[model samples]
Target: MNSPLSPIDFEDKRLKIKFKLEKRLQKELQALTKDPPTGVKVDAESIYRNLSEWIVDIDGAPESLYEGEKFKLMFKFGSRYPFDSPQVMFIGENIPLHPHVYSNGHICLSILTDDWSPALSVQSVCLSVVSMLSSCKEKKRPPDNSFYVKTCSKNPKKTRWWYHGK
Candidate 1:
């Protein structure tokens, strides 16, 4: 019969996994710092404070409705990052008034939920968010915003969103 790992073994395995996760995150951080997509900005402080969490700011595209406005995006990564998508949401006092964004900052982007791919990077996600805003025909919150914000789980990843015509 197979035996379970002892306490020491389990701890060692955890540390090893953590190390690997950090390594990957570090690589991403370097790349992001060196070259971030247009309109997306992140600080060394936020990314360094916790490798598992990052706060990125994006400016509304010049010709977009949200032009001259700024938005904060929060990304929280778990140990299985890269293998699993990070939890990303708009945060701060001003959440963009977008059709796909809830008042509470929950986003209904497909890649953040069911369509996630390990190949996607933090930079790419930020770029996607920028694109989402740039493509907006009108500035409005999601139709179900009120109900979803009041009843939804604090962790957006828990929600099963139906992404329609993004």
Candidate 2:
């Protein structure tokens, strides 16, 4: 006969997983700080205390519709990060008015959702966002922007976004 695992045992297992995740996050953060991607700047203050949340400042690409504009992106990581996509959204008063960007700051980028891969890093994501903005021809919100803003959750990760071709 075999004995079942105790509650204490389960707690211990959970702690171990949490510790490993935190260590991985720390390493990633360190690497990111040493060499961040172009136009992206991570908020070091938040990373000093917590690895689960990060604030990044992005500069709009030159000659683009958003040229000379500055935007702030908030990234929330789950324990399953690297394997799981981070929850990213534009935060602050000056959200971009791009068609793929909602009025409430939710972005409709495919890689941030269905196309995400463990191989993608924070740098790649930032670059991709910049590329998306640079390729835009119009400065406007999505067609359903009004309806989506009114009904969407505060957390962009919770929403099921329908991505159109680029």
Candidate 3:
């Protein structure tokens, strides 16, 4: 016979998971601080205020179509964290004018969806977003951006999007 989990045991398990998540988030912060990817800037205040949410500022590559532009990315990590991808989106007034980005800040990136992996870190995500912007040859929005933005879920991660690149 098997016994049900006691309240004490359940609470202890919950705390252990919480501790692990906090430690993991802190480790990532330290790594980002020690050696951040090019063009990636984390809002230190956000990290201190709440480990669950982060605000990152990224600059457009000098020779890209978005040159001289700065954009903000907000990442919201749930309890699952590394086991699950963060809810990442472009935020603030300067959202990028790219086909993969909705005006409302929702992004259609594979790694944030079907391709997410526990091995991926915050730095890698920043680098990926930068690389995507740097490779854009045209300045345009997706044809369905208007409809999608209106109908999309409040949580961008829940939306189904297509990926055109590897």
**What C-alpha lDDT does candidate 3 achieve relative to the native structure?**
0.89
TM-score of 1: 0.93
**Error at 81, model 2, angstroms:** 1.8
Model 2 worst lDDT run, 10 consecutive residues? 42-51
Which has the greatest lDDT?
1
Candidate 1: give the clashing pairs. none
Residue 164, candidate 1: how far off, in angstroms? 1.8
Please report the candidate that would top TM-score against the real structure.
3
- Model 1 worst lDDT run, 10 consecutive residues: 40-49
Cα lDDT of model 2 by residue, 1-166, tens digit = 9788799998998898888878877777787888987788887777778778888899999889888999998888887877889998999998998989998889999889888998887778888988998999989889999999999999888898887687
lDDT of 1: 0.91
Backbone clashes, each candidate: 0, 0, 0
Tell how far residue 72 is off in model 3, in angstroms. 0.3
Candidate 3 similarity to native, TM-score: 0.95
Candidate 1 vs candidate 2: which has greater lDDT? Answer: 1
